[model samples]
Structures are given as structure tokens and as C-alpha cells.
Target: MKRKLLVTAFLLGALLLAAYPMFSVAASSGDVGGLIAESDINPRAARTVESYSLESSHPYSNNFDYTWTITEPGATQIRVHFTKIDVENNYDYVYVYDYAGSQLHKLTGLYSSGGWTAWSYGESIKVRLDTDYSVTDWGFAIDQIEYEGGGGGGGSETNVLTDGVTSSSSLAATGDTEMWTIEVEADALSMHSVLTCGSADFDLYGRLGAEPTTSTYDWRGYTSGGEDVTFDNPGAGTWYI
Candidate 1:
């Protein structure tokens, strides 16, 4: 009887050990880390193709500074694309900002004699600018912006437009609602926003095909007159807008 009981106990211990990995895998599978998936927008074939042009005295000024609040917090990855403008000494770039308006990612190096260029998604924070002596037109026809994973399966994402696109009459300056779209593949999602300059603002909206069920948030920033937005989801998804 003693030997039988000992054997039963040993068998139970082995079974638990075997079950642990499966449980761990299930947990790990649920946690794929934060990744910004593929993008729908494709770069223009010709860099010389000028699809759109900024209005005179647009981009707000020769020097532009703008900010985009990340409605979804804890985003680890991001993808941004833009249409390159044609001009002499023209430089364009994007910057990633934290909740406190702190610099995070600076993505630069896109110069346009003419054409469209896109920036790939990665983990970085700060402002990206053009490196040239003569000040040519510096701005891109921004097509789309995407965010991926971050801390605790959720991350904060935000962007600041500065020293580049500065005119109030520009497409991005008019608070153009038709510029871009946001998508989220997670189970639940949330968002918030704040506009500093009345003339220039970051207008965010969802697509028509599919949408997530969650609360949208909006808050005003301490400075710069912009709002801080935050969005949260219950679980994960293949994509989030």
C-alpha cells in the first residue's frame, strides 16, 4: 500500500510538471509583446509625383511645430507615411512625444526634390528633421500613422510636429478631417484629444469597415493648448485603428 501511494504521488508530480509548460505557453501566446503590424498605405512609385501642395503661408510657418496625442496608451510600435514635397533644401521628418510632451523618437532623413517617402515603424523617440543649408520647402503629405505594442501589453503613443510643417492654411493646419484614419484590432479600445492652436489641430477618427467597443477619452494639456487623449482595450487584436 505504501509503495502504491508513493507511485501515485510521483505520477501526480510528473503530470503537474508537464501541465505547467502548456499553461505557460498559453500565457505567452496571449502576450506576443507589442508589435506594429503591416500598413495599408503604399508609397508612391515616383518621388517626383506631387499629389498635393500646401497653401501659401501654410504648414503654419516656415518653421512648424505640431503635436498628436496618442489615444491608445502603451503602444510599443508605430508606422508613419507621408507624401514628399518638391522644393530646394526641403527637409521633412516626424517626432514621437510622451504624455508629458517629452521627446521620444526623432525620425528624419527624408529629402524631396519631388516624390513620396514612407517611414517604417520602430521603437524610438524624438524629432526627425532634414539636414541641409538652404531652407527649401519642408513638409510631407502625411498619409497614415500607426502604433504597436508597449509596456504591460498597452503603451502610450503621441507625436509632435515642429520646425517643419508650420502654416495654418496647410492641409494639416486646417484640422482637415479627411487626412487619415485610426484602427484598433484589440477587443476594447479608447481615445482622447486636445487641440492647442485653434487653427492647427490633430483631428482623429475611426474607419467605416469595423470598429472596437470602448470609451473615448479627451483631456487638455498643461501647456501648448492641446488636449491629451487616452484609449484602452480589453484584449488584443490583429490590428488597431
Candidate 2:
């Protein structure tokens, strides 16, 4: 009788050990983290950061808002591309705001897809997805790039830019020129500047000089929307854009 009882106990223990992993998975699958949770991402600084992807955790819940705020120095504008936007169609949507905290756009699957891209006119953008307490999907992803010179066409009168910082200003477009100056304190493998336009049409231009004027230009760029000027062996000096 005792031998039979020991054999039965050993069989029961083996069966439970084999089934524990399966049971644990089943339990976790139904229990999402919480009703309210937020994720914040701060990228590496000084170096240029070009792209980002964001999503809710597995088994996302309803009645929640996942907000993302990105702040970058030396950033003039941020371009966003929606790669995977699968929300609850009509109700659940993603909202985009500019650095001034103004609503730039509202996106959803009804009008957007994986290839749709948007541009923020300011240095930072806040993205949020709000869902009702109903159905849920896998959420969305946005890839972003920050351009330094605020996109407006460069004008003539040079404005000095602080080292490794972005300055936001306006262009009057009086046919004069708006310029920015940067003094390189160290050697750089490459030097580049970007200009993005807002409303008025202006032409972009850049040059290297100890001092820049309308007549003394080493290089010029002619792009309506935006332009980039790069130098390969840009010896440390003053760069005007």
C-alpha cells in the first residue's frame, strides 16, 4: 500500500510541474499592466537624433492616453511619419502638438496609413493617443527627424546662433537678408546647416567668413521649402547661414 501511494504522489508532482508554465502564460495574457500608465523617452543629447518609434505595451487597455513629448536642442522643425497606425478607427485617435502647445494634427486609420508623414513647425511636438473604454488595437508608431534652422529661407542680416542651441524667430521678408552666425570652437569632420520656410517665400543662402555680408558669400543655396549646406573639410571658423 505504501509503495503504491509514493508512486501516485510522484506522478501528480510531475504533471503539475509540466503544466505550471502554460498556466502562468495564460494568466499574464489577460492581465495588462494597469488602467493608467505613461511612457517618456529622452534621447541622447548633443548628437543628432533622427528617428523614433513609439507603441503601447502588449494588450493595450482602453480609456487611456499615451502621451509623448519630445524636446531637442538645435532643432528647428520635426518631421513625423506614421509607420503603423492601427487604432479604433473613428473614436480612438492620435493628436500632435507643436512646441507652442498648439494642436497641429489629428491622425487615424480612417485618413492615414503607414506612409503618411507630417511636419511640425516648431522645435518640439507632443503626440497622444486617447481611447475610449471599448475596443483596442495594436496602437501606432511615428518616426521623426529634427531640422536645425527652422526651415524658413535664409535672409541677409546675420543673427548669431548660440553654440548647440536652436533659436526660433520670424522673417519679415522685406527683400533685405536674414543671416545666422556660428563660430566653430573645435574641429569638425563635417559642417552643415538647414533652413526651413514657414509662410512667406524666401531664398536660402549660406557662406563661411570671419564676417559675412550680402556680397561676400562662399556658398549659396536655392531651395524654396528647405535646404542643407554641408562642407567636408570645414576648418574651425565662423559659418554664416
Candidate 3:
């Protein structure tokens, strides 16, 4: 006899959803944590090939203080992707500020390439470089500015998965939960799901039939980026996750 089950994914905090695949049901627009118009909700933009460049003072001079503002009118959130960061650790600093002039991050020293700042709310974001007279290194560059389109050309996009495919999405605030449904086949041998949280930590939960809660979930993944849930000789029904 083929058993039926539902799986659900719950996030305790903000994070990215990378891959959720199996012989399962596709997530509908009405599903909890589903897509929304960029105008309605300020969701984070997925990293893309398109990029812009802003480099620090050439030769990495000393006593340099400069601020650059990047704006897209009506934009809800803004982010900067750092391609390179090499400055005197702690001595020299790069500051990130939001449109309201509130500080978001202070970075220094060397960081692995492709580091990015958290999404800053509003239409503008400021990046400033402050250096001491004593020492300096290669400095940093903002190679990419990511944000969701207020309208036209950027809207909610959904991914329908068949097998072994990944979909990317981001959640905002604490206790945010995004869910999807999956259907297992009678011949299916196993069901697996993976969640990859970048820079932030999140939790995943799964259950059969109805939505799963933090405590009521049948399957839970508690590791960072290492969260995985698999069922062998699985049931043949819809899973909510």
C-alpha cells in the first residue's frame, strides 16, 4: 500500500531557500510564504550576472573619506556585493548605510571574495570608505547592486520543479515561514530536501497532510546549510514543506 504525507518548511529567522526537490507537488501561489509582487512586499533580489562597479580611492590612499550613494527611485531595498576587500584590518573601515542614514555594517580586513551586505530598506544606500593616515591595503569594490524592481520587468516568479532542481527565495524578519507541497510516487524510493542559508541561520520542518509547525513537524532540519531531511521507501502522497 502507498502511504500519503505532507511536508512543510518553517524559518525561524531571515534566510535563503535554495533547493527543495523530490517526486512531489509544486508550490502554489496561495501556499504560505509564496511569492508576492515586488511592490507589495520588499523581497531580496537574487544575485544576477548584471553588475556595477565602484572602487575605492586608487593606490589606497590615507586619510581618505568619501561616500557614494546609489539610488533607484521607488526601490524598496538595496544591497551591495563586494568583489574584493583588502584593507588594514580594524585600522581602515568600510561603512554601509541605509537611505535614512542609519549604519548597517562596518567591514574591515580581508574577506573572501563575493561577500555582500544585507538588504538595506528604501531607495538609496550609501557606501563610505574611511582610512587612517597610517596604513592601507588593496581596498574594496562594489561590483554589484541588487534590488527588486518596483514594477514592470520585475515581479513574482515561480519555479515548477520536476526532479533534482533548485529554487531560490529570501525571507524577511524573524519567525518567517515559507512552504511548498510535494507528491511522492508509488515507485519512489526516497524523499529529500535541503536548505542553504547564506550568512544567516534558519530552520526547516516537514509534515504529512496539514502544514507543519515548529513543534509539530514530523521531520526537522536544525543545522546551518547542513540541514537535510530524507525519507526512505517513502509514502505516495502530498507533502507540505
Give the best candidate by lDDT. Answer: 3
> Candidate 1 vs candidate 2: which has greater lDDT?
2
Per model, state how many residue pairs clash: 52, 13, 16
| Location of the lowest summed lDDT over 10 successive residues in candidate 3 | 28-37
How large is the C-alpha RMSD of every model relative to the true structure? Answer: 24.3, 24.8, 19.6
Model 2 per-residue lDDT tens digits across residues 1-241 = 1110000000011111110000001111121111111121224422233554444433346876645554343355654545455678678877877767687767654322344234455555666778889988766555534344443223233343433334345554355555565444334555555555544445454555433445666665566545556655555445656
Residue 213 alpha-carbon offset, candidate 2, angstroms: 36
Q: Which RMSD does model 2 reach against the true structure?
A: 24.8
- Give the Å error, residue 9, model 1: 69
State candidate 3's TM-score: 0.43
| TM-score ranking of the models | 3, 2, 1
Instruction: Give the alpha-carbon lDDT of every model.
Output: 0.29, 0.47, 0.56
For model 1, the stretches where C-alpha displacement exceeds 4 angstroms are 1-60, 63-71, 85-138, 149-241
Candidate 3 C-alpha error for residue 80, in Å: 1.0
| Sort order, lDDT high to low | 3, 2, 1
